[model samples]
Target: MVGDSSYGAMSIEELVKFFQTGKVVGFPTDTVYGMGCLLSEDCVAKLRELKKGREKPFAVFVPDVDSAKELVEEFPNYINSLIKKHWPGGLTLIFRAKKGLPPGVVSGEGKIGIRIPDFPPLIEAMKRVGSPVINTSANLPGEVPPVSHKDVRVPLELMLKGDSKGGIPSTVVDVSGERPVIIRMGAVKVFEIEAITGKTILLSEGNVLNILYVCSGNTCRSPIAQYHLSYCARDLPLFIRSCGTLGFSGSPATENAIKVMEEIGVNLTAHRSTPISRELIQWADLILPMEPVHREEVLSLGANPYTILPFYEIIDLEKIPDPIGKDIEFYREVRDLIVKGNRWLEKHLRERFNP
Candidate 1:
């Protein structure tokens, strides 16, 4: 009704009414073209028939957080954190299904995947329908899902003509397990997930090294090391973050730290300090701390002893001192030290990750 003229067009209100009455419709999503219907048994059966008898559990499209909450069993704090950061976008979270969902809504393992899609009109339609809809890619199983409404092969009662910001499918995270597991890697990267929940996430793709750099305030040493190493090892399979053991959250990197990094063409102006958290310590495959005291703090936060390696100790270099109140020259010296350490680390990571 919105764009393509091949099919019968309908107003959004009419579309909502059709959905409420269990008619399948095709539409654009933030990620790709999709077809959906109400979660009623007859509607789900028709949706499956349209997809050529595919039987994989379909993701439920919920309009809002409250709607999502009603469909799943209780979730953990980290799941809530991920929802806060990634919802209304291209991330689908799977949780243990609560009882009494429609037959096709829950997988055999009793888990249900749900997403609050970024598309405004579709979300509004679901909100108006007052029930979750069964959403699946707009193609037969094993076929490339359509990115535009015109490319859709499956016939529907109506196709809401629109464009899809197609890249990869939504990233799927399963929180029904003892730990969060990434069953599918799509639009969202592993590093972005780690930044939000501070838990190292392994993909079905393979292993990825996660490094957490720590310092006193996160404004000087750790930021320098994090940015320098990130720039040097841009292609490696690594996720890097910096935090302060005894630091203020949301504090910007010092002027000296920013200026020194600029000399080497690495931008530190965007770096903001975050205090080291238990989630962060748990997330790191390797924890590189600026000083021995920082390493001790990381250990105090329940980090594995094997994971906490002081940077100077590991590289056999003298400890890089903090340059908070020091002159620009001192900051430059610190930057040089971090560069030397990062150079050694880069070569080591290259050998290990082979990226």
Candidate 2:
């Protein structure tokens, strides 16, 4: 077993040799020690064979969100949103696998668990290696995970000493759903991870809630509210959509509005102006409008069953302002107001929908 010391002190050549040879090395993570091998078909096979473990499945640890994105296929916007809020930390997300990864790694489940450790040594090693590393606990099957290198078994110890730069285990968080659920509570506290991801780590299964926004023209306030709500309701599996009262269909969001949103890191360039329709109104559980008049329009379409909330009421309820032909500065002010309103909406949803 590797001794409890900073393997980070070793030269890069030594670290590279160890990983290339497909040896499982113990490294420190933000939470605990982790055993990993190079993430490739051959290396994965060697690690599994060495562990004498079943093809149950395995996770990969990346150095950052960009790397995770490269590895996973068809990652949804919600997944990107989660990474924006919680990665470069201790959260682990399971996503559909892309073509490059070996099927044995994820056990042909078509999904893979990925993590980005916060520790420097592992991060440096990953950066140097230019790919993900196989992540599993540093222990034999049915054995308790080792808390430190000294706790690793004799055979595993030799590999750690031979190859690992800093064999530390990473804290694991499973985000394969609307909210994260902790399978094992380790180095990172559940609340801490939840705070970053903005999603509660559920202990049991439950329903996912959806929220929608509607207005006359998708260009102005509705789409803005949709994106802002996405940030505020980052914790819930809330579905956010925006449509206009009239079909300008295929029109781009106004340039000034896009500028305002981009300031807060929301890309509205792809937002096409979609008009409000009976089907849309019926599809929504809650239809928030920019003004009271717009709410009436939605209600007239038999959308009355869905609650009609004012943008300010759901977001800042008291500060809804007009944004038509406004200056970039005016749009910025409106954007800030919407962000505040979404915060209020978040609290409301959590209290009302949380089971």
Number of the predicted model whose lDDT against the real structure is largest: 1
How far does residue 96 in candidate 1 sit from its true spot (Å)? 0.2
Q: What is the C-alpha RMSD of each candidate to the true structure, in Å?
A: 11.8, 17.8
What C-alpha lDDT values do all the predictions have?
0.81, 0.67
TM-score of each: 0.59, 0.49
Q: Write the per-residue lDDT of candidate 1 for residues 177-204, one digit (tens) a residue.
A: 6556777766565456755776645454
Candidate 1, residue 96: lDDT: 92
| TM-score of candidate 1 against the unseen true structure | 0.59
Off by more than 4 A, model 2: 1-11, 76-86, 157-182, 189-201, 204-355
For this target, which candidate reaches the highest TM-score against the unseen true structure? Answer: 1
Q: Write the per-residue lDDT of candidate 2 for residues 1-355, one digit (tens) a residue.
A: 3433354556344456577676666765654557777788776776677578557677888887788879777565544655665566556767768776787666465778888766566667777878678877666788766666667662663333322223333445455556665554433444445555566555333434445677667886778888777866677766788988777798888899888888788888888888888878755656777777677788888864325666756553543677878788888887787777777777767753454
Model 2 residue 135 lDDT score: 76
In candidate 2, position 35 carries an lDDT of 73
